[model samples]
Target: MNEIPLEHVHVAPDDGVEDDPAPAVFVLHGRGADEEDLLPVAAELPDDHHVISLRAPDRLQDGYTWYELDLSAGGLESSQPDADDFRRSLDLIVGSVEAAVDAHGLDADRIGLLGFSQGAITSLSLLLEDPDRYAWVVALHGYLAESHADLDPDGIGGKPVFVGAGAGDRVIPQSRTEAAIDHLEALDADVTSGSFPGGHGIGPQELDAVVEFVASRTA
Candidate 1:
């Protein structure tokens, strides 16, 4: 499998990387943001971990989108890309995570994912579909794809998942966020949700919550 090509930035501990397998986090950017966008968020994370931020497959006119969206209905509509292309992207991400873990000699069980907006949606879909691939998931301002209802979390077990949403998010509706939370909890995920005072973006309080969630699960 091909590695997920990530435009990355790394932050190391004062003691430097150890010989042991280090934990890692794969950061996915939102639509219209390249790999560089969310990589900065890694600074808020533990320095002991290797961090990766990946670009979506296709470029939009100004930014990028994971898969094409159909707006014929006057609003965003989900459309599945060609099966092969979608699967290939997923495989690439999985391979990249796997390779990074092996390269760092880090334990596979400690790998995690953090995504914002469109990236968050992608991470949730990947986790729901693949099962047991991540130690935890940080989905910020995102949704569970309608396709996710087909998943059975029995295969993935009880991996912790944290979601941060905004009461005034125009991109991803709050109602939709609630629906996704319901679905995930139904599938038996150890899920936590926090809504903050903001719009389609993150605020200080929300960021703190996310930091706490990641630290709690990974530590």
Candidate 2:
């Protein structure tokens, strides 16, 4: 087993496994939120999969951030990510996932990613960079980063992807989410998407859809 590159909290399966390696879910929280922010959501998932929530490396006000936002071009809704920081964080997350699989005795082929906001952007970027590495993805309230717009990875065909967005989202904007869905669909990804009434946050309906999407794939 190797050392995980990021700080994280791990929850073992409710039904302990003695022989088989368990499926794993990596949870990445939004900006300014710690690993524990989405810990409670793990309880709502299937009892047999390993749940690991990772803390972003860069520290923000009272929490953490995956990357810094570059607002020089426009307002928060139109801002882009700091290219250097975004790339660095993407590499770190990939390394962390690799190390975590070995450390936790997880099923490497069944790994899933659940990320929110900036974390969601990172997850989508990761999937685009190496489509075959992950089994499935859940990106909530985030847009596709422009940095990866030119990528046309071969293995992304029919890959399961869940993208949830807030219709009233003022931070990232609903149009951004729509653009991501369009891009993924263009790549032939099995994209399942939803839009809720809130703003930059996951609602109960969205959460239910997420749980169902994950369960269907992981089961």
**Relative to the true structure, how large is the alpha-carbon lDDT of every model?**
0.74, 0.91
Error of 1 at 200 (Å): 1.4
Clashes of 2: 0
Model number with the top lDDT:
2
**For candidate 1, lDDT tens digit of each residue in 1-219?**
433354344443437556366777888888788877875576687777777676777778776667665444466533333445456666667777776665555568777899888778878888997767788999988877655667785555577988888988888877767777888888888899988888887788888888889888877
- Candidate No. with top TM-score: 2
- Please, what are the lDDT tens digits per residue for candidate 2 over residues 40-109? 7766887888999999999999999998999988889888889999988899888998998889899899
Of candidate 1, the 10-residue stretch with the lowest lDDT total is: 76-85
For model 1, the stretches where C-alpha displacement exceeds 4 angstroms are 1-7, 10-14, 17-19, 72-74, 77-86
